[model samples]
Target: MSGERAQPVREQGTEQDADVDADAASTEPEADTDAEPAPVTNGAQSVVRALENAGVEYLFGVQGGAIMPVYDALFDSEMTHVTMAHEQGAAHAADAYGIVTGKPGVCLATSGPGATNLVTGIADADMDSDPLLALAGQVPTDFVGSDAFQETDTTGVTRPVTKQNYFAGDADSVGDLVGEAFALAERGRQGPTLVDLPKDVTQGETDHEPGPARTPDTYRPAERADESAVREAAEAFAASERPVILAGGGVIKAEASEELRRFAIEHEIPVVTTMPGIGAFPEDHDLSMEWAGMHGTGYANLALTMTDCMLAVGTRFDDRLTGGVETFAPDAEIIHVDIDAAEISKNVQADYGLVGDAKAVLDQLYEAVAPTPDADEWRAQCREWKEQYPMTYEAPDDEPLKPQFVVEAVDEATPDDTIVTTGVGQHQMWACQYWEFTEPRTWVSSHGLGAMGYGLPSAIGAKVAAPDREVVCFDGDGSFLMTCQELTVAVREELDITVFVLNNEFIGMVRQWQDGFYEGRHMASEYGWMPQFDTLAEAFGAQGFRIDDYDEVADTVEEALAYDGPSVVDVHVDPAENVYPMVPSGGDNGLFALSEDQL
Candidate 1:
């Protein structure tokens, strides 16, 4: 009755457990031994394998001569690699991917120009508290300090922006350095972490055995809210007549959607989200008022200005959000809660500052404040404002597709959980306005740095993070071309992502300002000579669909979504359509460009 499994255990170990011996004897040694071990690969290959083992399914980067060996290894590995048109695009893609997945996004870049290009994205992620791991390639170690070709001291360049950085001294340290980079990127008050691997280290051979993965010993978890602070905040909320909850990206980062919703409902307090915090509360909720900044909703701005108390969570009161420091919430008593202590009272003065994770803080507040059955008067006021200026777009009977219509159609066609990523431009604004985001971390874009060419590659990263979720990019024609080369990566990886190019043949946002403020001098904004995007997508082995008529938008989007793999909808939108209600740069939120009359 003894099984084949009995032999291996009996032979390998002491005969203490007969059942273990029986099971071990049942299994064949050759079959078990044939299993492939971790590859004894080069530093680059080991780096890629370590990422894969750590559950990093996607890495965004642009290929360069210095990093070609890494790319070769990445190509041969199982981890998904997304090639962006620019290093900035890769970094932004990594940032957005991390935001959506709650994991450290991996971005790769070569030294010198490549490393420099990632600076803005790195700063953006740092400012936003996003988790990102940047793998930068340096010149050969022999060329260090010599300023050889493509050599740059990336560690020095990125020290201020990253949580920590390391310069790989040899091949043996590459795997451990990468693991540390990931750990630092995700630990408390998350930010970008960098690892600069010299070309020699990447190509070098080492006889050292790859050690077992080491988790950080001093991993600092996000702080929980003190009961006393939560009680004070709750008491203030209970007492105020016009209390509002200002939710920010921190809420999304803390995954406090349920807690936020419950807290808002219990207290009958209206919720307002910052641009980056759009989906923190359900957009469909009666109390949800998205974006209360310079370009924010009029009612939300007015509410902030008139409110008695402001319960701020996960957001620093950025100048953009607070219409310059002087005029922002002049009448409100502010209570700021964030994981980062530095963010507390950095801009607008806070009456009470509580440093803690947003979800933990909100949970404590919910417990302290007993649920109010109703706030009919407050709800009515918020509803009235919502009814007055609901986000909308008119289907124009025109020659070219309208950006608003395209955004709305795409939003309607995609599933509720589908993630949307955007580039910076008129198209980014249009996506922000027209799309109804009901879930937190669903909408990802470069808000802090306002970097261009972020959409397509970010969508690629988003798709990689949530392979089961449909990811769509709202890209302007100019922005599309900025990182359009990434379409190849999507095609090659067979990522099922839909890129909706709002083809206006011009940098619409800049063109608008030029037309309105600069005496209509077109200058360098036009892109009429650009390649046909439909043809370009087809060339990349992806299905291409063009929308000429406004009526064809929904159908075109549907077709793109149904396509086997990556697809692009090059809709020729009207170049004249401007992102309106813009607060001119360095202008107050109160001084908005209302319409043609205001202009």
Candidate 2:
């Protein structure tokens, strides 16, 4: 049921007496059990009841004194609440939930430290255009500038990162503010929104009626590509012997997979996706190529170099995507299409810029261009590139386990439609490399911010959003430990999600740098003390599996996937195994890691 349509029906007779008694007891002194019902319920209770009416099944947050009233109200309500180890975990979970479900995910936090902690997650959602609503409890309105305990200017702090923000001075506005927040967060160019509700306001009461349901203003996303522009693009595409489509996260946001596929197939153009765009095009499709730019496939980079025309859609050409802009695709005439005007020529200058929705733009392009005869020469060239530099991982015969083996096994065991979320580091890259993403929005990760410890919480949110679908987190041991405390949340909520931790006993990325740049002077990256993941999982009341042998990786993953509830699989991988094809920091993309002999 839609949130707007799920308003609760008030029950009639004797229940009102019980509610009245409970309300009376909630406000009266300890000795007075017969005090008249409190003058009115506080804004906190109003907000909680509003959420209940809106059919919110769960909320993620960490408790703080400033927000105690809201927590108290939540305890008395039916909505499930998941407490996180950190505010960032709550924010990331909310972002992931919104991305997976196309609804506004909510995160709650208190003043000062709690509000500041959510900054990274907010910026991440902003950069990636995910829908999220963050409710931050603020200090009382009277203490606005007093530097009072737990007080912070949350509205100011989140202004730049959020699409919209509200600071509630009137308690009666809480419900309407939340409704507006949800609408703004999910509107065009979707992004996070913040609502700062002061503690005093939360505890205050007013006689005003609850505000009417909010209806979001219709947003006509710019316009489709013009006839002339479509004709020009089609002419350029048809004439170029080597052309490619660079798809970005916008493709998934706009749900343009069908149009993208049709356009690519009709023109015999190969498609490459950005990190967030991994699942925008099916990885198994014949025309799909691995990602481009830093850490991209060798063949994809070479193809970018050789291509005569590049059509980029719904993407910002980030430094990672363009390598060094001065030398990237010098021979290619770039045609950029995006809904955001600021991104059109922000980095790499485009030969042509079309501002519009991805699906709408592609629809126009499809209409303008007539289906062409098969490009046998282009297909042959692409086939050669694919065969020569295909992404592959050969497990070492003597190694305990390879992360790629675990990733591949999980991919094979899970259905094609399953959603996969990842934490940053080797495991994230391995999931990108080994997992076959066939549907849009199926692969969720901290692509822009590259935040660690996002996997488990994000998986929790995804499962909540799509309860019928299988959700899994591909995490690293270091990242897992950072946010593993949230496991209790999964157990408490009984969320059906799987967490696969690649336990290598080291920060593999940092170790790789130490080996490459510091000549193997392994500093503080190694962990001499190890936590038993199986025990940790059991403590949280979830099934756990540990695999140390390469041969047992597949069976263990299968077992974890079959578990009815939340489960964790800790697969021990070779500590020395490093993610290769790396573009060294402060260097051009061409200066990638190579063998000592090559160097």
Candidate 3:
């Protein structure tokens, strides 16, 4: 089904400061107990109450000994705790929850292994800029350095991945720390933040306060572009004959897709999305060129190179987007509009840098610049490129099934409001290409870090956070094996979702790269000993279907989607297939290998 674009939940009291603090956050600890807590008291109780105050609706993670007190506190709380099969899954679920709901996702875990298990997901969140708040149970404060049972330096391990972290020293500090953790996770460039609550803190008793609503004093992103810069950008846009808009995740984060669409239409400019910015503009729009970069659409890469003015908004020109600084969009004088000042000239230097919130920047630019038509020739060229290098995949008559066709069929059958999520690799790229997302926050995947097991858990979070919407998770066979057990939670919770496994009996993307880049040395790539995926589904108490031909795709997908509960459709696909139109590492973006045989 079609879904509406998501809107961000803005925290009140955010003001622009001329001298912004560079640090995202600092240690927030308090010991005041002068105020009295209501009829109840305890550090754990304070923590739960604090979460409630921050408007947290769901918590995901596994429980353990050191965290029992917090669990006891949650016993009577309104927030729902989803016990994932593993802590890593919990972290991903929370990350996905935040992505869909525009709120900081919360995950709870015990110390030691539980805390460590969240590292991968934490890193994933860090790389993708997903908002998450992780709460961990620690050993007693006395045994912090002593390495007591189930003890771990949660703050230390997570510090590198988080915006900031806190150590709860007493009952009075638990509530304050929770508020700070939420603020930190949502402020600036969002990512994971943590609060390591020692067992003593949970057991300790004292009066607590949730503190005032946090307004970031030091870490405020620019809300609007400087007047001079906006004027220059408008002049640049007016002068350039061939211009393209490079939209990225920042557009999604800023909730500026509408503004982006309006700006693009007004200028009659073609738009290309960065990987994470897939849905920033409707793919079906005449001005839309799906995506550009390493494995992006061939026409998109060509347009980027050929454009005279490349207006990159809310995107860091990372290595993936810019194959090389000198060769990237060689003809374009790039004008970058971003919230972060450092990203201005970090990689591909911009002729003009306008630092501001995407929505505000686009709004002001819209007013400063009027619709101009100087690109009839450029539009003709882009349309020709799209026609000549159209996105296509072959389905050999003798092959079991083609993965791309499976995705296409599913896309056609799913509702207009369906939320499609994916694991990293061939499937992710296919989803990016095949699914026409007209709305933001509907497409979720692990883009930057390419975490394999991210799909299932994130799908769970999407389903949980937006129960009225339909969620479909596209997972690879290998990636599915990494964390398929989480499907059990779907069954237990009776969550309505469908998982499609592209069973190719190999690490499809890795094999594809090895074939092209490493002279066909396929080592440790194929899944020679395949598991019975259908049986695995049965083990999780979900219906499973296996298909060996393309004809079965339609019927099976329909059947699965129609099923009352969660189901897995395992369709055997061609093992030797590869994603096409890939630009080799360090290769010029203009010179892409259009398909597997092209390179």
lDDT top scorer = 3
User: What is candidate 2's local distance difference test score?
Assistant: 0.80
Residue lDDT tens for model 2, 1-599: 11222221122248889999899998976865575423337788767766655556767788887887788767666566767668988999989988887777888999999999988889889888998889898988998999999888899989998988999877887867777777667756779988898988888876443443353556455757666877887777666777888999888888888899988877778888888888888888888886876677766676676778888999998877777788777888888989877888899888888788889999987776654524667667877978876777667777568888888888888899899998988888888888888898799898877888889989988887788899989999999988898787777667778998999888877787787789889899899667889778998899898999977877788888888788998788888777766665534554554432222
* Candidate with more favorable, higher lDDT: 2 or 3: 3
lDDT of 3 by residue, 434-515 (tens): 7777778888898778899999999989988898788999988889989998998888777778998888888888989898
Distance from true position, residue 311, model 2, in Å?
1.4
Off by over 4 Å in 3: 1-40, 212-216, 371-373
The lDDT values for all models are 0.79, 0.80, 0.84
Models, CA RMSD each: 8.4, 7.2, 10.0
TM-score, per-candidate, Cα-based: 0.86, 0.87, 0.92
Residue 399 in model 1: shift from native, Å? 7.0
Sorted by TM-score, highest first, which candidate order results? 3, 2, 1
Total clashing pairs for each candidate: 10, 0, 7
| lDDT ranking of the models | 3, 2, 1
The Cα error of candidate 1 at residue 418, in Å, is 1.3
